[model samples]
Target: MQGFALYPFDPPGDIAALRADLRGWLTVNQPQDDVVARANCWASFDAGFSRALGAAGYVGMTLPARYGGGDRHLLERYVVIEELLAAGAPVGAHWIADRQTGPLILRYGSEAQRERYLPGIAKGELYACIGLSEPGAGSDLAAVRTTARETAEGWRINGQKIWTTGAHFSHIMLALVRTEEESERNAGLSQVLIDLDTPGITIRPIIDMAGHHDFNEVFFDDVLVPHGALVGERGQGWKQVTAELGLERSGPERYLSSHALLAALIDAAGPDPDPAVASLIGELTAEMWTLRQLSMSTAAKLAAGEDPMVEASVVKELGNAFEQDMPRRVQAIVDCAWEGSDDLARLLRALLIASPSFSLRGGTREIIRGIIARGLGLR
Candidate 1:
């Protein structure tokens, strides 16, 4: 194909084959109980499950075959993610790598960088974390103070990154740093890959409001990285980072997080759906389907080499809000006890406890709203 600009694949394009294959594969090789364990703990800690996903060829579906990938369509990756989330599969171990870093690196990294990192990412043998947020820089990405200066060997990095999810265990941290001081907030910034074991690097797990240490604060003191560590052109981090955020924000993951409890609530309605409850479930399901379509379309746009920035923002804003509110609805439907002997009760117990952090994690509501306004030309 000379270019995909003229003909983008249809959203949710011909997923029948992929769906059937994934179903069969998962049926025979479903994850162990430890894979989908809920609450403060997750599958991210399970090396076995991560390896199994790699072995099963489900880790980096969209990457090229040379990198241990399946070379599947992006929509196929969508199907895989949907299956895992719907099944409540434990995927915490490789989630960040599979979700963001792999795709980000594949798109902007040098050929050597791609060859070096993508293979292990494909096999789920390597883990990666993003170092974007800091204690004072949440949502205002331009405020990140981490600095990297040219050194005889390469670059010397210094400063701290906070709210780096899974940093405690990740092998690599792809961090955004100020390459040179500029009067403009977004000027002279870049993204670089840092080895977690580099000299003078310290990672401290920060307990989230959820009372879990899934996130961390990483301090880098003169951590040296080769010049190749930069993912894209230096001073383009402002642009590259936003593009990466589009991928981060637009996906099934945005709304699928609360699906288990939503399904449970419908299950509690019994043999005959309660008219009111049925309508509520219908509304939620319709929203999920719509978000899925929008997200799929955004991927198709990206594959066609067109920026789906606006569409991605719409998906992120709506889908994240929808997912964030699902647990609140669950809590409102019944008492705080959630003692009913039903599937909804069990799922609600978990989702309710986990709901509060949903909005704050990926992109805060304020950040998303600003993006939406800018996209709409209302800002």
Candidate 2:
């Protein structure tokens, strides 16, 4: 009936029902103690709230039900996550674990590994953080110098990871470390699961411009993890991490991190906004809708058991650009006389402070563009 079929983005009735249920639950259970703090949205780490979400069976919706997960489709998970972020719920505590780590374990971890971690993750009791970017290797993961050497006891890890968000509060770290020195860059790397409380490990806080301590520098000094801690296989880290980054880059989180601020901007601008303000809102909303479709397409691919690496990179690159641009656009449009209603002023201020990090986190714009170029065979 058509030359080209429309790509599906709208959820089915069942999925719509799931979204409604989650929205209702959030209305009843979302924290009211600090609205400004909640404005951080997905970045607001609240362990107690995380546990509550887990108790509601909302944490690990896509993993195997045997591991205490809901065993729902990835699209369903996407629905839940987007609703949570849109509501400005505190999902930071279990975000990484549920989003990528659980899936990583399911795909590559041994049965024992999955059994050890998946249940707790589904329960939202065990928190995990990614130990990817280092001081010297931010987006260039191939330059990672953190080394895990073979020892009689196990693998002894020694190195530092920077910009490890939620590291301080997390129970475990899925760290990418170099297991071989002779191989070329990206060939010798491996991922290791390390207990954050292991001896000789240090976590130093890195306060952001907003004075938030979400990011941290984690140092491992002769820390020994059992051989069982290795995920997938040694020297296969580059492959594993590349897959994980696709998961990291394409989620609703990439685009929705600043959504609370966008909502606040609209609320502050009021119903009948100026032409300039209306134009700004219209542009941002259109961009967000486009990005959401792209992101959901990627999620659908994941549900279909396909890796949308190239598509994910595209979404991330564009989404990061839009997110980073939003704060400045709002600042330019809004009048200085328009003081916000409720916590709009505070959320706007926080968004301004945190905007600089939009392109840096996940992957830098330069790095993302490079990935896009490679994907298009333009490199």
- TM, every model: 0.90, 0.94
For residue 265, what is the lDDT in candidate 2?
A: 76
Candidate 2: clashing residue pairs, number:
0
**By summed lDDT, which 10 consecutive residues of candidate 2 come out lowest?**
1-10
Mark the 10 consecutive residues where model 1 has the least summed lDDT: 34-43
The best candidate by TM-score is 2
Put down candidate 1 lDDT per residue, 140-257, tens digits, no spaces.
7788888999877999999999988888879998898999865357888899999899999998877765466688889998888998898889888889888888778777777777
Error of model 2, residue 115, in angstroms: 1.0
Quote model 2's TM-score: 0.94
Q: Please give the lDDT score at residue 263 for candidate 1.
A: 66
lDDT score at residue 50, model 1, on the 0-100 scale: 76
- Number of residue pairs clashing in candidate 1, backbone atoms closer than 3 angstroms, sequence gap of 3 or more or interchain: 2
